[model samples]
Target: MTTQPDHGQELIPRPERTPEAVRVALARVAPHRISDMERHKEQALTAAIADGKIGHLRHWLTYWQAQVEIERRPDLSARYRAALTAVHGTSSNDDPAFRSAMNELAAVEAEAQRAVSA
Candidate 1:
């Protein structure tokens, strides 16, 4: 079963960087994305096997490990999306909203990094 952090907790210990771990975490926190994740995994595996290189699979695992950190945290996920929206919605970097959004995005990314590294 997928595990979630207790209320008020901001991080969960980094998950094992494996497809099975990613799949289980996705199932727990982002069930709707499981199909897409599986599809990406299939493509990564196929490309890795065809190329006789493991880089493709490694990239997939690394990318998803960070993603699961955010997906598993509802507050962070909302902040991430809002920051993206603010960044996209503003045309000028000088805009206060844009600056604020950039700061928020950086914070969210930092938190995600810490969660993954923890």
Candidate 2:
């Protein structure tokens, strides 16, 4: 039988090597919105996969992993609040200041699809 390592030992802490966008986004979206965020994430991942953006896939995976880890923590919801405060505009769906931001992002995403096809 093998003994487990010490609790203090570092064996690859979560959110390891994830992009700031993903890490921060996971932290920013509301706890209730996490499921929605995850859905959007899956869409992005599917798009990235279809487009052969392997790098983006890795980032998505890292983001998903971090999200799972975060959700497990008791303070995960608070972390999301802090993230929202830090990256105010990226959350196109929730902000009142940027009324059209969500629409604009949707348009941009659509354009990206068209561009990929073209």
Candidate 3:
């Protein structure tokens, strides 16, 4: 029912109604619509596919935290808390804020492991 602002043609619901809620949604499909993304979409798709695969990372992290001695290792506790906070903050994996939180948590695990050896 919606008409173009300048033209007499009616707007199609698919393109007009679909809001780009996530990067993957925008990258995989919206790329054709956006001139700037015409060059970057393939790269974005590759990165998005890899990034989307959590593969029980959150579960493993929780297990690592519980199995490790957090009382003796403060670093482990820090990682546990970081993961908990990250998971609690958002459910959307594509969200920028959530990605930042997860990246911070991912680093915490390595830092904790280093502490165990040191």
Candidate 4:
């Protein structure tokens, strides 16, 4: 099993980036989102099979894998939601708070991307 470095501390086991793995992780971390996950999986599978291209399915798996990583970390998940709320609460994109919230959201997303890609 592959392990990811956790800030020079003990290595964290990296979950397999597969549909089954994602489902299991979702069950453990976000059980309520399982149906949504299944819907996305079905859509990705249908698109891939119809087009004879696996890109859509692969993209779906990667996206969900990143989401699983984010959800696994409570701090990251909370920060992500808070940043989203801040961004959504703003009336105008021109507002400084909006930009700050967007930056925070992007940073959290980047962390998730690293977690998955690692």
Candidate 5:
């Protein structure tokens, strides 16, 4: 039987291979968003496939697991947080920071897309 490589182990060195922007994006995927998609994976996949996109079960597993390594690294987390705060402004102490940050990041990413295609 051919054994599969443990991708989690293989991915440990991946962040260094990417540019800072990519590293920040990976580290900063909001866990709550991941959870929401996971909760509705069946429907999301069906809709995505209907729209001819490549979404599938476990499509996010690799990236989500990669988050662990990203978050564990102090350098990556610091960069991620900085990038997020820059795009999103600041949240108060009692606010839900991750959600706020993700919303801001999404807006920033969308604006970038618009500018690029304009």
Candidate 6:
């Protein structure tokens, strides 16, 4: 049991031991608690690819890496990696365009990481 001051009048404090109340509070906070890097990494990559902003093969690779690293979602990561494989072709991972795209995506992902850290 606890007491709280209400403008100098004493009032009974609410108990903090309710499991249902705690769950509700956590649910309300979960979205803000999720790291921005984890939430936005895939959205950014999906937007870049859909908008033709990715200029090289490397963009796809770096995007895939971020999906693996930041997202850490195996199902979604596998799809992104498969798309990358389709775009750059397994035999031509050495392609320059692919490399450029991957590098550009890496830069974008690095910025996102900094943002999330901040």
Question: What C-alpha lDDT values do all the predictions have?
Answer: 0.79, 0.47, 0.43, 0.80, 0.46, 0.41
Each model's RMSD to truth, in Å? 3.9, 12.7, 20.3, 2.9, 11.2, 19.8
- Stretches of candidate 2 above 4 Å error? 1-38, 82-118
Stretches of candidate 4 off by over 4 Å are 7-13
Count clashing residue pairs in model 3: 0
Worst-scoring 10-residue span by lDDT in model 2: 1-10
| Candidate of highest TM-score | 4
User: Tens digit of lDDT per residue, candidate 4, span 1-118?
Assistant: 3566553322234468777877887788778989888899899999999999999998898888877777877777888999999999999999899999999988988888877886
Mark the regions of model 3 whose C-alpha exceeds 4 Å error after superposition.
Answer: 1-71, 74-79
Ranking by lDDT: 4, 1, 2, 5, 3, 6
Better TM-score candidate (2, 3): 3
Candidate 6's residue-wise lDDT over 1-118, tens digit each?
Answer: 2232232221222223233332233233333423543444456667777887754333433433333232332333344455566546535658775676566555546743442233
Q: Could you tell me the lDDT of residue 96 within candidate 1? A: 97
Candidate with better TM-score, 1 vs 3? 1
Stretches of model 6 off by over 4 angstroms after superposition:
1-91
The true-versus-predicted C-alpha distance at residue 64 of model 2, in Å, is: 1.7
Q: Between candidates 2 and 5, which one is better according to TM-score?
A: 5
Q: Give per-model TM-scores.
A: 0.67, 0.33, 0.35, 0.81, 0.35, 0.27
Candidate maximizing lDDT: 4
Q: Comparing candidate 4 with candidate 6, which one achieves the higher TM-score?
A: 4
Candidate 2's residue-wise lDDT over 42-116, tens digit each? 887788879988766665655455453444333442444454454465556466644454454344344323322
Q: Count of backbone clashes for each model?
A: 0, 1, 0, 0, 0, 11
lDDT of 1 by residue, 19-90 (tens): 887778877777898888888889999999999999999878876877888886778888999999999999
Query: In candidate 5, what are the lDDT values of residues 1-118, reduced to their tens digit?
Result: 1122233332233333232433344445444444443555566568777887755434433333345344544544555567677546645544676566666545544533332223
Off by over 4 Å in 1: 1-7, 10-14, 88-107
